[model samples]
Target: MSPLQQPGAAGPVFALVPVAFPAYLHHDALVDADREVDRIGAALAHLGASIRHWPLEPESRTEANAKARMQSWASREHDLPHSMLAWIGHGAANQDSGWLAAYDTAATIVRRGISVDTVAGPVSDEWLERSGDEGAWSIVLIQACGAGTFAKRLIANLLGKPRDPQRLILIGVGSEGAAYLGAVGDALEEMLEKGFSDNDDSITLADFAYRLRAYLGRRVGADLVVHEFAPDGGTPLRRSPVVPGGVTAPVNVYHELRAFLERQPPDVRGHFVPKAQGAELSELAWYFVGRSRERGRVAGWLKDTACGMLVVTGGAGSGKSALLGNVVVHSNTRLRDLLVDAGFIVALPDAEQPPPEVFDGVIHLAGMTTADLVRRLAEVAGINPAARAAADLDALVKALSERTLTVLLDAMDEAQEPAVIAGSVLRRIAALPAVRVVVGTRPSVHDPQRRNPVTELLDALGAGPTTSVLWVPRDTEATEEYVRLRLNGARKAGRLRATATAVADAAATVAGNGEFLFARLAVHEILARPRILAPKQAKALAELLGKDQRELFAAAVTRLSAVSATFDPLMEALALSRGRGLPRSDGIWATVATALTSGRAVTEGDIDQLLDAAAPYILLDVEDGQSVYRLSHHNFREHFESRLAASA
Candidate 1:
């Protein structure tokens, strides 16, 4: 029976198959493959695909059997003619090299000219041409590094057919040195399954392609090698039928690179969420998980407070930046859209650092000193810096505040200037009418007297939950959903090779450290090279840490040291374990806390307190809570414990 004709073959008949090689060789690749399966499954479900999944290899360690399984699947054809897609999760451009490389099987199939259509690359050109010769509807998507360059050849073949040649689209991601394999694969599959999409009448395939290139270029801070085979007037493609409103989202929204010391834009929408360990935070994790609703509440309060001071605090790696990104970016988009919708001047605040000469509306990256903030606001609002004396700055501040204005301050803790002075200036600015100000930071440095000083100055303000507002640590459902979405995206792009379980397990392992930071970083690393960790590397890490959970945690914790210069791993360890009671000695407590917190989890004392509170069971001395201790959860403890050993 044609697989497409199976029970649920209703909506778009889509097949998302991730290629695994010679028996599951790359563990990281396997993990990546698993993500692809889940994602493809979810997307197909969303698009309404009656799906049939077949794993190339079983979970057992036997290689020969797995190879047989792989061969069987490759030869197996669908009973019905439907949209067929496969992800070449792992392979080298060269047929001879790499651990999981299956160049021979793939190459042999191409050489023999077995019949199959709708092929995407990461498979060689030789195979694609043979498939084309079979006269089957072909769309070849490549996940390999340089697959983009092959588009012309594919297009040439399709042009010979009676059908529209436009059915074939090639996308690429990666560097100029290689073919545009990733982008081409991603775009081609999206185009074929969804059809051309764009809401704006002005948008086209060419426009979409250009935008994709532009967005990718902007994100990576570099240009993409987008060469056109047959321009075909590159019409603006419509939005996918699945999503309403059809307004095209930027193709490469997540591509970000560090520029100069300018203020970074806030990312409230969690643009980076898809790349994290799991979508939502796990409650069992040490930190509190937060939600978008909490973010809205805190932001609403910031607007209402009208008083100058605000502070947000949390432990290190608790997602201060992620939250700030959402609050700032989302609000700005909202405000800008509102203005545009209202026919007001669509004046966008410079996302880069604010210049001395102020602008129409205000949006500032956190970390600006109060003095600089005030001066810039005053300058932008047409306040005459020449006429206003230093003291008269308050007069100008009040005048400007009376006008329609909004303020956003991110990374308050990272502010380079004095906190007290910045706080006072903020207070004065908040008191002005028609002013809305939002300030975000880690919770440690908050001091009413030193920061705000005035009663009711920040009374209307509220704290955004670090976990929920920025990172949801315990929401397994959300995490799973997120995992599915991201990995599905990866699979669609053809970079993944395993199945759903592999993706879920990898995410779970990364989440074991139970921190959002690690999960995100791991995803980024995985996407950079979609493959399972080699057994050697995985084993090396395991030898150092033990279980996957522990390894993730220790690696995450260790990573914190790299962020802040102040991390004293020993100090962090001692502080976290303090609840168990004083360890045998003060030196031990200090040593352990310093070792743990100092590395990355905690830096300042207040943050240390929060981190310690998050993992109460870890404390050895619960009674007086004066002694050092460790997490009771074997997974958490073992993870950190291994880190201690690894560091040694």
Candidate 2:
């Protein structure tokens, strides 16, 4: 079967028809149009898209001829499930009109060029509407000077015909701006190359548009205007792997993992997350320090080939996830150095040993079930997650047996079915001889009566090493280091009036026996209101320190509420997402905000401001092909829920 017609394929299949009109009788010929078309066609073709080029013959370059050819092509190929129709050449626009120049065209007049109505009129309307109704998507890529005007005219034309604009996606350049030679083609190639480099299986229209605009703005000093009327950021354009069987090369794996980490929200990336310039003086890297003993223990366990699993248990905000995240991001190289420094002789891998492939796996498990875990594992192993669970598990095990694999799984305590994950999926994976697994979770969950998943996991591991992250009394040194670093940073950023050591001492005094999370909050509070550190404000500082974790959180919420009226509703909407996250799409967020606010007017600006204010508490990442906003941690959600309950 043709790949496009295959049954139950993993992603969308595309067919591209690139039409180029390079020469014009009464205008300067588009010297690079043919080459640009070829570049774009080749890029799409490499992604398994069927490509058909229509380069107007010298003898048949008239506008009338072009129209007939497009009409005929549409009649034959309009039934395609996903299609791209690209026109590359001259485009002209005036105050109220736009036209794509045919080879014989002279100017913006419809008599000399193909008008918007001519392209989407009697020949293509029926096909577009019918195909769209059947869930098919069509993208129109017009690379011309006034392409933006063309898009507007095309949209108006469709609307006048009473057609659903959602049937198509339109990509064009600015209405009044000029499109430089090779700009569109180069942008497309770069976008595809990035997706390939990241090991992404597909790129959605919205994602493509996002990248295109960024590329053009950065590289060509041009503008890329896109309108996606289709659902869910328009149809996804799937890309076939350059390598066979979709297996990633070792280098690509590193790039892919790095890209994955970059995509994670700041909080999830832990101490490595970058902070905005206070002269790079406020770098968050300072937040992570003095976990030397824990690092050494984990490294020692990793060096032991006999040990297949290591469990790191800690209370909330005890930095369990941060430690594991550091390891995953840096990979085994940093761990090996740490081990060496700790006086353990680290051996190089033998030539016969397989190359190590590290998978970040799943770092957050708050909403995951056993099935979700299996599917995620399959994805990490480069197997088809859509396959039957048993088949996928077998494939995963077989794949792991052939190579050395290191997997990081965090937040087991947050998973919906923690027991099942700990007792079944993780237990089984840890049994694989060539695999090394590290898991992070709390010592126990809220329900003390039930057997904790950590206990279950430990029981299943038998003799595997376990590490615990204790409360402040044990982690005082680390907390003090963190405070000192943050205060020094504040001084450098000119946010503090006092000396770093003095302020650090004051902050530490207020933090007392609080955990890292509490210390972090306390530091922020002190920085926000530096006067609280004065000797005269000792009682105020004491009052601030008196509040526990929950109280600190409530205070943060109160401050956030003061930022915007939409704060509570936005938080509620995110909580309703159940950790899935709310899309960054304006339409989606507008609908959500409107409903939550009971029809109070909320503009996109309002939403943007709300997101900015909530940045410290929420996570931003791409999920399902679009950027989404998620609560940074489950604790925030729990706190919000408790507040809601109290009000009730």
Q: Pick the candidate with the highest lDDT.
A: 2
Candidate 2 Cα outliers beyond 4 Å, as residue runs: 1-167, 170-203, 206-286, 334-362, 381-406, 431-436, 447-474, 494-498, 525-543, 585-590, 601-607, 621-628
TM-scores across all candidates? 0.33, 0.59
lDDT of 2 by residue, 1-648 (tens): 011221224433566776677777777777777788777766665455666666557546677877766665565453456677777777777877778887677654433567787877732553464453455566678887777778777777666665455646677765554766687767667555542332344565565555555555454453455666654644466554322112111232233334444543433333222111000111122246666667656555665544277778766766676565544423334333433454432333342112232443434565677777777677666665456355455666667676665666776876777777877777677777677767776656562234644455445434533332322123777777777777776788787777655677765774466767677667766776667767777787788778876687677778777877777777777776766666544346546866878667554445556654554565544334344556666676777777668888
Cα lDDT of model 2 overall? 0.59
lDDT over C-alpha atoms for residue 222 of model 2: 39
Tell me model 1's lDDT, rounded to 2 decimals: 0.37
RMSD of 2: 10.5
What is the C-alpha local distance difference test score of each model? 0.37, 0.59
lDDT at residue 185 of model 1 (Cα atoms): 33
Residues 601-647 of candidate 1 have per-residue lDDT tens digits of: 22223233333323322322111112223332333444554556788
lDDT of 1 at 371: 54
How far does residue 99 in candidate 1 sit from its true spot (Å)? Answer: 56
